[model samples]
Target: MIVKKRRRPLPLTVLSTTFVLLWVLMAAFPFIWTVWGSFKVEQDFFSRDSWWFAIEGPRTIAQTGSAFTGDGYYGAWVLRDFFSSVVNTIIVTVSVVVISLTFGTLGGYALARSGYRYTFWLLMLALVFRAMPHITLVSGYLLPFFEMNIWGHLPTAIIVLVAINQPFTLWMLHSFFLSIPKDLDESAMVDGCSRFQAFRMVVIPVMWPGVITTGLFSFLLAYNDFAVTAMLLSQPNQTMVPKIASFLGTIQQEGNVMFAVAAVVSATAPLFVLVMFFQRQIVSGLTAGAVKG
Candidate 1:
């Protein structure tokens, strides 16, 4: 006798869509609020004493028609200081990404190819380094460098920023290197490649996606950081995140147009462009490393 097969149920497409929508909303909420606040006058920002959202609050700007205004962004972009901050942020971010990725890739490769005994010691060292709070390192070097007349400056700040970003990059790239099969290294060596040459020629290309991913993360950390920058670089010519934060403290905070606009414009494009540039590589590298097949 032939038996009839039961049909499987449809996938939870609607539930999946709802979950995605919720996640997107949560992520986009702060950005939306910032964008909206950027358009409105300072009065609208401070006048609303309540935490809850409302369609309209007080008409602080005295605009006749819409609550949306370009005054804040306009103020931020019209100053030379704002542009200087942007330049500083770019410099720090580039330095951190380049240095971190270079050292991280080397350290990672070494850790990945070393024997289990070597790996344990290296892993312990990494853990110790990573576990040491940035505050500890910052404080340890703060006074010594300050006495040298360079700590409270841009050069020193960039150095500290790169140092703080290195440990995370080292760990991330190490994992990426470990994910690759040993056969690739063996095959490259059989083809007359030295160990370092094999790493440079073979592993580097395969690990490019991981490098880009980690670089983006490092760049973001360097670009958005305010604490180390504020502590290490106090000069007006130094960096932007601290500049923006400093501007927030001044009495005429409303007039700091360049600060507001620069904040909005800074991370918007580079992040989007980076993702787009490595979109395909990111997907392939992620899956290729994670899956056995």
Candidate 2:
């Protein structure tokens, strides 16, 4: 029969798998290279064995003319300044997240539940501020803090970070709040709850995912900020992101163990924790919003 000549179909599954793998590599190449490079010695950073040239971390420093060695990630982690900066980053991120969520949730609930007409304009203004280039905002405010001796402490940075983060946070939370049925509010009031009580008991519980998402967004945004933190904070209180950048600049001429250690510890670790902690909530909140609309 003609079936005797049946041909095998092209291995589309293999092709699709290959394409997905390639895309993931393309998306993750920088992070992967950075992680590998974290294990490299500073002296080896520019060597032939360096990932900059070889697509993975350095294996040996040329200075020794001998075998490769370990970079001193252990020592870098013990560096008092590294630890201090890490503390500062954590404090900043946590503060921003909590404050942003507290304020954003309240503001969002008000706008969505109160039927305010001005919310659209307020939202537009928020988009404008968020859309403004980070460099420009940092530069514009730098002199006021650096030159004028205004609120030039860590508090200033916190304030600026929170203000910059709030608009989008409020908008995102507002969308989430709007997705909740108004019938819930009515039912709560019918059950002897006031507006504030209803929000506290009914709305807030259901909106926790959105609140968590906004908090993580704010935390990550504050934690990873470079220009703003650099401009606002200094010395022992400098945020980890800017400090890491400083380390990269100084290590350009040396063995990169310290830089690698700092890069991995400062930049990658918190982000990993953040993703792991709130990953499910983030997905659920985002998906719920999408489906609701």
Candidate 3:
């Protein structure tokens, strides 16, 4: 039998692995700590005596007669009506994603397929809009929304989010469309398909990887947005992020720090599940335009 030789990892490889592990720990540890703390009362969780009090769960056991308690979740979700915020968030996120994708795909397809000189200028204009801070745009809308009497509603937030989300969506989908071979659509048209038919039959199926990626981003933006939602929405129309923020202001008076922590954990869980489930599609979509073949 031939002798086998083992190769040692390069120093750069070792360094990179160490760095990645450290970054993951740094990112994930706080969320993990918060989840653990959510089961404990404020005193034990935040105790200066020892950090292990949160892990030991003695106070938690005494209060709930178990090693863990879900009072925080109950207090936030049921007692405080956090589920309404969840519903509002879902409505805005879904509406924004659908509307943004519809317009973005059409706009991107035109930009990709057209040979017009105005396309460049249009894209540059979109870039300018994208680079502007969203808060600045929100200020401009406040007066108009008040005049229109549509302020502090789901529709208003959805429209604003869609408009704000469009520029980036257009640019991203434009790049994705460029990655696809034009001949695919041309071939479909040659087979007696209309332009829209060609897109529907040939382009759309292939473009989904990129679409899914862009949609995921849109979902994230709408879901995590605090600045716009907090300013524009009425108290009853608040989303999860803003609601969690409201908790911070009232936590001192209410002594419900665990409720805020539990809300954070609740809000984070869906994103975690989403990322875990669609990680492959996300990676593929991000990398679709990186290589030609």
lDDT of 3 at 40: 82
Better of 1 and 2 by lDDT: 2
lDDT of 1 by residue, 97-132 (tens): 898888888887888788879777777777788788
Sorted on TM-score, highest at the top, how do the candidates line up? 3, 2, 1
TM-score of each: 0.76, 0.81, 0.91
Error of 2 at 285 (Å): 5.5
lDDT of 1 at 258: 32
Candidate 3 local lDDT, 181-243, one digit each (tens)? 999999999999999999888999998878989999889889988879998999999999999
Q: Scored by Cα lDDT, where does model 2 land?
A: 0.73
Q: What shift in Å separates residue 238 of candidate 3 from its native position after superposition?
A: 0.9
**Candidates by lDDT, descending order:** 3, 2, 1
In order, the Cα lDDT scores of the candidates are 0.70, 0.73, 0.88
Candidate 1 Cα misplacement greater than 4 A, ranges: 1-24, 48-68, 251-293
* Model 3 lowest lDDT segment of ten: 284-293
Q: How much is the lDDT of residue 105 in candidate 1?
A: 89
